[model samples]
Target: MGSLDVIARALWSALLLCVISFSSPLRAQPEPIELWHGRVKADQPFLDKLFKQFTAETGIPVHLRYIIFKNLKVELIGAAFSNAMPDAIIAPADFLGHYKELKLPAIPDSEMPDTIRPRFLKTVELDGKRYGYPFFYGNNLMMFYNKSLVETPATSWKELRVMKPYYDKRNIELITFSYQEMYWLVPVIGAYGGWPLEGKKPMLNTPAVISAFKFYKGLVDEKLVQSDCNLQCSLLKFEQGKAAFLIDGTWSYKRLEESIGDDLGVAVLPYIDGKPMRPMYSSHVLAFPDYESQGEKQTKLDKLRDFIFRKDVQRQFYDEIGQIPTHKELASLVEHTTDPNRKAHFHQLEHARMMPIEPEMSHVWQSLIRGWERYSMHGFSAEESAVYMQKTVEREIERDTQ
Candidate 1:
């Protein structure tokens, strides 16, 4: 009970308390990874299932924050500037170029399994380093027509032209968007052996581009296509049964199924000649933010990445959300041939094309779409529109390069 004995006993008690605190499960547990994603209704079932499965297996909790697609970029940029970015994000391929410019954290091809990397049509890279893992890829653009009304589907754009009599007699129009005019144009451009874009340049000013523009313009000029057709209007026109053939992505399959039910007949978008041009394909990728404390975050991010690509989760994603699986092994897991229309969608992926991932690619797409719009909406000459598009694209490329 002397002063020295009391001091020794007090020191021992303090050390014991420190050890207990260090070993406590509550104190040792890692923080949950924060995930930011778009709140698409199609993804809900998959998210619920995957989150439950992920938490159960890895013991790493995921906190999800949903942001609208339009606002997501702005919010994410603000978060990045403030050093408050999410641990992981799910965004479209178009936005990947912006993330590349910001130098975000990404999982490279070398890091991913060999089977998974090759399935991705577009390489998700930034500064020669891969930055994202692709999850859902939809490249198939099918023409949805009412089978009961139209007995035979058009196999080519030329065949589509022949159906003008049927369309005019029946007063049925083909619905399409100016932006998606690329789908119809691609086949024609390919028939004439033209590329959508040349090496870092837009090539829409070519003879092929002019011809394709004129083809669509002729449809409008002849009153075969609806004059007010744009992205929103086209889909609406199709849903209302005013149009026979609607050019749209595979993502519209579920919505169409729910709305139109068995009345819908799906056909691959036809080529100009015998060969069809590939439909533009892109995917949603998971990427990490550039973190100050990367070491700890990397460990959690790697675990989440692995969990996402697991076979069971990928299968669930395909089944619940019509998102095409990225895992090569799971690609065939979508084989529910019960629905012939859905089965055709899987077949269409064989001839799909991914959009260019270059930084100036958006400008290229915009310029091409503008040219098509001017030719279709206004009375601009095809040659004039093509020249304007090519010049605008060249300017955009030069600006981005500088």
Candidate 2:
């Protein structure tokens, strides 16, 4: 045993240790949970604050990206094809229709926070599985009036029609709304005893649709509503006291309250010929995409979900933004609140129907808008327009399914 042999053995041992260290994998750092959403720009700050708080509490960082609502779906599909999809999406419940296409795994019902209202939870459930977390509900249209201009809100369209001449003489429109939006037209169809969707099928070619078209045109012909005005125009007219009433969705409540102050009065949609104007409503949801691929990231997402649905967090959603919270207790508070506007909103929700959650409902919307444009701008007869809508949507559904 010489000094040379002792040095060679030590060198060999060091070389082997270096090779093993280089070959073995080091522990990987946790990835930030990535989320994509189509919510309005105003929501970003509040959402950022929430995410920051979550990171502070759990040491798990979150990254968010905002995509335009119209473009969100196409991009999600594109990303899915490219294997570059985000971990989750916050979007309207209609995105549930893409659950299969996006390979979004069902969020076990047991994993869902019990604080969410049952009805809101149902929006994300299709067949028997829950695919998303219901964030908030109550996007529906109601009639809002200027109390100073109209002493009483009209409960019936016939009564509203009777007040047209009075408003005309005052050089003000009796009512105003975004005349071309198909969302607004759903209530009209409901008043005529039709729903655009009955399960997965669209009922656009019915007598109800024809009547709805004719009724809307009659309002324009009788000078009861301004057909040329868009939503912003109608909002401005109402704010400036130029219009006695406006029809709009819950999303505009805070803005209307700010603009009109005490003069803002909310009411359920006016009735037509003994039928109620059942406006369509829907919930916004937080959905996971290709969740099975997430592996250990699921645990972090679980914490994020719990944080997002916490009672305090849900309440902030209402307090900060005008978004209605989906927590049962908070929704009950709003339902029973002394605030007249909140009460009116709850009452409207009582009469409103949830928008069809089926993916095919998208076709109904596209077809209905086309039919409306034909009747309004192209001079197509109501019956013709109705027939066109039904045929078009059916064709689209068939083509898409195929």
Stretches > 4 Å off in candidate 1: 1-32, 68-84, 106-110, 117-122, 125-128, 164-192, 273-275, 332-339, 377-379
Give the clashing pairs for model 2. none
Looking at model 2, which ten-residue stretch has the lowest summed lDDT?
A: 38-47
Alpha-carbon lDDT, every model: 0.72, 0.86
The residue pairs in collision within model 1 are: 106-131
After superposition on all C-alphas, the RMSD of every candidate to the true structure, in Å, is: 6.4, 6.0
lDDT (Cα, tens digit) per residue for candidate 2, span 101-136: 877888876888898878787778777788888989
Name the best candidate (by lDDT).
2
lDDT value, candidate 2, whole model: 0.86
Which regions of candidate 2 are displaced past 4 Å? 1-30, 169-171
| Total clashing pairs for each candidate | 1, 0
